[model samples]
Target chain A: MADAVIAAIPPGRHARLIVPRLLQRGEDFTARLLIQHPMETGFRRDDTGKVLPANVIENVVLLFNDELVFRGRVLNALSANPSLSVQLTAQKSGTLSAHWRDQMGNVGSISTEVRVAGA
Target chain B: MPKHAQRRTLLGAVAAAPWWWAAFVGTASAQSSTAGSDALDERVRAAVLVRGGLSLDIPVIVETGTSVPIVLFADPSQLRPGVRVTRLGIIAPKNPRPVALDMELGALMSQARIATNIRLGASQSVTGVALLSDGTVWQQSIAVVLTGSACYDGT
Candidate 1:
């Protein structure tokens, strides 16, 4: 329920999953994930000279057809609008979904379908 | 010899052996246990302190305020069977917070290669660490010299 609530909150930035709409069975594919966030390191101060609290995506999880596939833990070192490229082998066509949670408990997710071509 | 006599002879031989031999075995086991703990300590330090690993795929030379690209790779076939590479992390030791990026590798993923962009606050080495499900950690670090610095005030 907490995750659902977090997911339901309006996303503060644009997040996109870039994948081919279709793929050939057994084809090796690369998927790119893009999420727009400041990746605040808490080291910077505001215009008023107050240190900003650190806020960053603590972890990210990716699932293919409800099976855990990829997971990542990120730190403040990532530049603004962090993106990741990952390789996958397409054994079967299915939905690839990604979920990420920030230090502040904000959650964001995106999904795309990959149609596997018949031999 | 009778079976009972043979058992008594074996016991007598063990009791007659020098105490130093027993000490040697004890010492060997103790040394092994220490080595295991030392390895675990190293892993904890690497994961937490961003200390060491394999090799980083970034230019040795760089400039400030630019998006630096980095890649980490490992042969999937070399990984232990049924063990998935679950986590990848990047850190710049000199930064305010050294950690840059960390991601999870999806299931049935073979290649352990990852690429991403990062910003440098100063000239420093960026460390990348890969974590496998089998508790194995692989790391690599590359040093990059930045000509300037990126100024930022949290807006």
Candidate 2:
């Protein structure tokens, strides 16, 4: 993973969402997401001996077809390059979207479509 | 004293040592567990918490503390029928912030199974708590040993 390249990307562009493209109604499936971040804790110092400010994702929300499904509040205790997985039931064919905001006021979002058959 | 009498005294003392050790260590751990739960209670704002409804899956021994993968599962058998889990949280009592991750599960969730990674400052027991729609709270803790300390020193 190139840290420089990831940093250069605009906020929310570094987010990755992985979900099954096809699904059967009423079946349980897992949706995984990863957001690239340094997750600074403010206790760390840079090479020049200056203390680094804490910068981490503060809020994360996941929605399916505009219906809220999950929301998360992350603290500095989470590891860098935070990733999360949750089990969701296939209801109707719709969009699965993830949005997050960092401590520094940077926001990012990503979405994927899942088709549910027999719905 | 007779030789047999002296031998009997030595054997009795040896047999009692384990019980003594257990009593001493048991009290220490019990106190720590209480403190851990108290911290969690404050974070979740719940008065009473029932243990054993949730399970935490993590390595007993981790080579590094930077990224420790953990999975939390809600036991349906332990929960009341028709009561859904509304929230799930991970608490690291020894870390700077006790609440590592707090998540709200909506109606779309079929089950409460969540996976994530966390940072530990040292070897300590981490707690996982779940809140049910019926206003009941459940929690479970797991001890982890970290050979390499993380999050304490400046990054």
Candidate 3:
């Protein structure tokens, strides 16, 4: 009866995933994914001086046609909306799935398809 | 000695004698709970940053925390055609923890320009790194000062 509310992670904006609509095989492919999250390092405090909970998507997994490929872990050094780019062999056309989970049980998912058939 | 304990001991040590070790096992692991953070530094260096390349150090040390700036400019002549920088990250040697930032730089559409805020854990030398079209890594470092820490309180 209620829609799922996607609240801000805290310090982070929110999560976003980007990728090319089509990629040519035999050439380097760039896959981009951005995550908008509070990415709290569990270090800062609120106006009331409360140590915010450490909430960040610590792990990211990329699946090409259900095959594990690119994965990343968020560290304290990353900016607000974390981004990822990886070089993948454009061998075949398939579905690209990206999943990220934070320490606070928050999850983000994105998927894209590839057309590696010639140009 | 128990069977499991004896076998485990033998596997852990070359001669069953502990010389020394860190809590997290490897140097990177010990420095930061996250693995693959240290090697990411060396990898990015080999992939993008180079000499002849202009290095830009992002200077912003706030407790609120954001990705610091560190950019590299390489001669387009040196880059292979259609080679886009897939990701850029920052590496620190003395931050008491690994600080890594990742971003998808639109290579095909835009010129090489990566400028953004980065999260700093502490005062230390931060290296900017990038990954190019061929999976090669390139990086350059800049020293920064931190009034407060973001990772753990080593101050």
Candidate 4:
């Protein structure tokens, strides 16, 4: 039986990070990336008598042909998983990069090499 | 004032700093709740700034918090040469802690998409706060409903 890895983020809870690679033709490609960030509502508390700190992933970016494409910031009002679907124009495939940044100045960047066999 | 008085003043100043901050946070939270029914305070909100364009909230309707999926529309191509979404935050009135999760947006393009999981507290309104490079702020909000739902996560 083939093995499958499941990446799931708890409901109402935020994610830590996510990286996705989009592959199309031999020379063209699209990279879909995302991170898990709990849209902290700043309400609940732990065992201690103090309130818990808020944490969530916010920013995102997509690169194609070493150029920039989709870009936007995530707000506190968003739900759990930041579902993003961007359109990337592929030309002379070099490398497609997907990057995600959170509120705490943390960043996660992943890249996929492009290989176009057919002209 | 006498030397002893000066010392006492210094001690008082040092001692009441956290208290003042706490008080300020409390009052601000209270005021925000009062001023805008759904508005959270700056302290509780963990207010952060972003670079270039701000990433406000991602206004949308959520059925539950367990498997929440968010969507955005800002054109990443318009962003300057080097910029990234650094942080994301969300807060609600019913949940225990105001924060849900935090992560890093590594060195990548501005046009990217993502999806994740989340835990919810009853049916309440949620907010999304995304921070960017160079210290700027963007935000989004959404309302969630939990019909016939019970808090059963025994973790």
Q: Which candidate is the best by lDDT?
A: 2
Worst 10 residues of 1 chain A by lDDT: A5-14
Task: Tell me the TM-score of chain B in each candidate.
Answer: 0.60, 0.67, 0.50, 0.50
Q: Which CAPRI quality tier does the interface of model 3 achieve?
A: incorrect
Candidate 4 residue-wise lDDT, B18-73, digit = tens: 22233223433453456442443333344443233333333245554555554432
For each candidate, give its TM-score against the true structure: 0.69, 0.79, 0.53, 0.40
Model 3: per-residue Cα lDDT over A22-114, one tens digit each: 766665566666777766667667767777786766666777777666445335555557665555657777777788777777677878777
Give every collision pair in model 2. Answer: A12-A108, A44-B155
Residues A54-80 of candidate 2 have per-residue lDDT tens digits of: 888888899998887888754457788
Residue B18 CA error for candidate 4 (Å)?
A: 17
**What is the TM-score ranking, best to worst?**
2, 1, 3, 4
State the lDDT at B142 in candidate 2.
Answer: 90
lDDT of 2 by residue, B1-155 (tens): 99999999988755533222222223324445664645543433433467757999999899888899999889878777788888788877777766677787898877798888888888998888777788676778899988876765634
Which stretches of candidate 3 lie above 4 Å from their native place? A1-14, B1-65, B69-90, B93-96, B99-117, B121-123, B127-140, B144-155
Error of 1 at B131 (Å): 3.2
Report per-candidate DockQ. Answer: 0.37, 0.35, 0.15, 0.13
Docking class of 4: incorrect
Q: Which residue runs of candidate 1 sit more than 4 Å off their true CA positions?
A: A1-12, B1-55, B77-84, B133-136, B150-155
Best by DockQ: 1
